[model samples]
Target: MKFNKFSKCLQIGLIAIPSAFAMSLTYAQDAGTRVAVVNSEKVFNESNLAKAMQTRLQNEFTKRQNDLRDSAEKIKTAAEKLDRDSAVMNEAERVRRQRELADQDRELQRKQREFTEDLNQRTFEERAKIAEKANLVLRQIAEQRKLDVIMQEAAFVSPKADITDDVIKALNSQK
Candidate 1:
């Protein structure tokens, strides 16, 4: 019984392999289908549009970042002062100062959180814009080259099939 089952499996595998190979050969021989690959990470990091957007975001957030730095320094100074003077102050005075320091620290943390959230949201928005523009450029290239498929991400792409440089040039040329 085991020998019969093994023979049947071997026959099925032998039939399937040739059928799959023939189908692949037929597909490969077709001249109408053209494929291309694009390095999206390279485009995003090296393109003029992406660089300009990064600069704009940096400028927009620079002031807030500096302010956060200043607030952190102030908090540090207050902490040090409290530590240094706590021994000489009355219990009530020490407690009040500690409470004030805690409040300031919380407020600073809240502000820092808000700043980080805002920066992340803005970065996401900017990335979306860049992706939209890149897609447009990619479609244009695909049409111009008569490509049936243009993959943005691939495990491996040959230099002949990579249209990343062309995409970057097109994006940079646009307003």
Candidate 2:
């Protein structure tokens, strides 16, 4: 009698598990999921925020760039003068002039290196600000449209689901 009861319980367990799995699958298929895609690169390239950042950086660095160019030109002129007059000068004077030229060259290189580092740091900061604003705009769009998911980078995205242009427009509208 115990053996018969054990067999009946085994049979019922097998039937119940398969039925439960099938019902869950059917329910998932019945529910529709909404999805969207955004091309972040396109938004960054086309947005007014990015453009303004570029302009600001150019303006900030222009004077420093021009000054560096002028210093380089002065150094070049001094080097040519030394080359031309070295043969006519006494040994001590020639050595002093050569040392001065080398010092100036080293100082110029140091300044150029600092300029490049400053430019790179500023650019990184501006890009971060743009990304922060873009994320806020993306969240707003997703909430407004009732989107379940918004993918930034994808291998393939249908045009029907692309909201990149909308993102650009929203960014342009903001200050």
Candidate 3:
């Protein structure tokens, strides 16, 4: 009967699908999938290059930071003096000093904004450089170790699968 033939075909198809899946799974296991995990935070923090870069940025920005600090101190001193002298100061003198204080405060704020923007930009640029260098080293390590996949961030990675130390070593070696 046609119904019987159709049932037989359906049974054969069902069996074939499971067999195909089993064969593919067997093939994949035999092919040896190698996976690795890298802690990018570790690589960035522990690398010699990153340390050097940080030191360089700190040194480069130190003078500007000091200048800003000095400006802030001057503004604070001026404001304190105005507050103390206002009781004795003439109307004209008090008004002039108040205006000067306001101007200085505005200037300080503008400088602070500029300094923050500049520092942020420089930090972003340097961090990008560090990341680029880390990625290059990561790729080299992966290729050398014959890794099929290297994860940057993971919730949990066994010590055996973590290649971050090797990556840090490579980064340090580049120093």
Candidate 4:
């Protein structure tokens, strides 16, 4: 399987739930406990910079795949031509073709390795930056809303409430 399918995105749920009877944030409340919800997925999906980074990574992978395929095709064509003419071909020509094929194989392997490492690094770095920024904005929004607690929408079983737009607004304003 490709690394992407196996590598799930990192999820950080920042929840400041009031400590119940003893929960820290709970106050002398006859009033219901205040809750704030932020949808991290939504924020990630909406970020323009994140989207661009994803597209760029995909394009890089595509280019590598195309180049590898082209190289393989050239090697295959060379082999076929050699097979047809082998009886009459000089030893030097045969050796040259074999050497070229070996070089191409080595180059393809090196490129695939480079792409895997580079793509994974870029993905991690970009995601970390985006997640950090989104969290910063979410925290600011929760403060502005006077929320007693803030939680990631997904982590909440029923998501008692949603302030995703508030978080998004805060994120937008941040820029």
- For candidate 1, the 10 contiguous residues with the lowest summed lDDT are 24-33
Clash number for model 2? Answer: 0
Q: Positional deviation of 60 in candidate 2, in angstroms? A: 1.4
> For model 1, how does the per-residue alpha-carbon lDDT over 1-175 read when each residue is reduced to its tens digit?
9999999999999999999999987886685678899988898789998899889999999999999999999989989999999999999999999999999999999999999999999999998999999999988999999888899879888998999999999999998
Q: Which stretches of candidate 3 lie over 4 Å from their true place?
A: 1-32
The estimated TM-scores of all candidates read 0.79, 0.72, 0.78, 0.58
Query: What is the lDDT, from 0 to 100, of the residue 73 in candidate 3?
Result: 98
How accurate locally, in lDDT, is each candidate? Answer: 0.93, 0.90, 0.89, 0.72
Model 3 lDDT per residue over 25-89, tens place? 78867999788999888876778877887898899899999999999999999899889989999
Better of 2 and 4 by TM-score: 2
Clashes of 3: 0
Candidate order by decreasing TM-score: 1, 3, 2, 4
- Residue lDDT tens for model 2, 1-175: 9999999999999999999999877775577546789988887678998888889999999999999999999999999999999999999999999999899999999999999999999998998998999899989998999876899878998998999999999989997
Model 4 TM-score, 2 decimals:
0.58
Give the worst 10-residue stretch by lDDT in candidate 3: 41-50
| Comparison by lDDT, 1 against 2, better one | 1
TM-score-wise, the better of 2 and 3 is 3
Which candidate has the highest lDDT of all? Answer: 1
Angstrom error at residue 86, model 3: 0.7
